[model samples]
Target: MQTSVIISTYNSPLWLQKVLWGYFAQDRHDFELVIADDGSSDETREMLAAMAPNSPVPIAHVWQPDEGFQKCRILNKAIAVAQGERILLTDGDCVPRRDFVEVHTRLAQPDRFLTGGYFKLPPNVSKALTQDDIAGQQAFNAFWLMRHGLPFTSKLLKVVATSPFDEWLNRLSPARPTWNGHSASCLRSQAIQINGFNEDMQYGGLDVEFGLRLRHVGIEPRHIRYSAIALHLHHGHGYVTQGMKERSHGVKENTRHNRLTWAERGLSQWLDSSNRATLLRDDRLTRF
Candidate 1:
């Protein structure tokens, strides 16, 4: 089945370049990539334009005007135009391993959503990563990462394991499987059924909130944390505040308490908005 990989990006073109390279190096190439841009400058547009021509798969850019943190809004827009049966959500700052796409595709089930995890890199290592490293698939190597400054830890096993070992690690992992923005996938129908993300959220636990809604609707969350890996590039979280976290906490609590499946301010609301047509007809999305 065709998959649309939706990557949310802001103003980090340099990190985005690496993320795109990671996709380019994927073992599977049957997927299209949709970039859900939350109002970045012209630089990001130009970068995508320059890189799109050589991409192995189709690429589309869905951008919204910058009005603080409206990730859910832009993501909803991206989901509206995505022409795939399944959608994989991630961030531009996370570089996937070569087998990432294949793993997600193979593990996908009709009644479940897949959630993966990322191995974070420090600022120095994040900056040190090159396109060659990602394309060659060495960036995911534990020794290569250690050589480039990642400290040794048992977590590195997530980077080195193959086959049965990875599967065992995934089962043993304590981290709960949720709709992680860094690495997650679900059916397009499933996402649309509950109306996409909650626009009421602003960065803190928003992904978890979406997952809670999916769970409410009887979609099981499956763990692919060890098998589908991504390397998270370091960046500042200036947008995150205690207030945002508190507000998101409340929204999640409301979801659990009320068993709310539909989002009040999500995809359906965006589609019914007055400007939906204009946004869909814009030149930002590329057919190639």
Candidate 2:
């Protein structure tokens, strides 16, 4: 089945470029990349223009006007336009391993959404990484990360283990299989059926809330945290606020308590409204 990788990004063009390079080197190239841009400047568009031509897979830019952290809105817009049977969710600041897409594809199953984890890097290592590092897959190696400033930790096993060992670790992991935006995958139709992400949410538990809704509808979650890994690039969470996080948390609690299956302010709301987002299709960079 065709897959679409929906990545959310604000302005971080430099990090976004690194993330794209990781995808360009993916072992599997059947998926499309959709940039769910949340009101970034022309700099981001320019960067996408420069990178789109040489991309191994098709690239689509679904952008809305920047009006604060409307990640949920932009993501819903991207999902509406995505042309894939399955959708993999991620961020612009996270670089994937070469096997990232392959692992997600191999693990996808009906009525189940896959949730993975990311190994976060410090600011120095994040900035120090080059396209070559990601393309060569050294950026994902625990030894390489440690040599470059990441302190050794038992968690390094996430990237160090392979095959049967990784599978065993994944099954043994206690981390809940939630809809993490950093690394997650589900059927596009299932996402649409749940009405996509809640547009009222900011950051915080928004992803988890979406996962709760999916569960309410009988869709199960599966852990792939050890197998499908992403190297999360360091970036400031200046957009986060105590109030917003608390509000997002409250919404999540409501979803869980009420067994909500559809987002009140999600995809369908955007589609029914007059507001529309711009789409960059093919190599033309033309608005659609």
lDDT of 2 by residue, 32-126 (tens): 99998898888998998888888988888878777889899889888877778899999999999999999999989988999999988899999
The Cα local distance difference test for each model comes to 0.89, 0.87
lDDT of 1 by residue, 116-191 (tens): 9999899999999999999998898888999988899988887988999988988998998888989999998898
Model 2: pairs clashing at backbone N, Cα or C within 3 Å? none
Which one wins on lDDT? 1
User: What does candidate 1 score on TM?
Assistant: 0.95
The C-alpha local distance difference test score for the whole of candidate 2 amounts to 0.87
Tell me the spans in candidate 2 whose CA falls farther than 4 Å from its real position. 272-288
By summed lDDT, which 10 consecutive residues of candidate 2 come out lowest? 279-288
TM-score for each of the candidates: 0.95, 0.94
- Model 1 alpha-carbon drift over 4 Å, by segment: 272-284
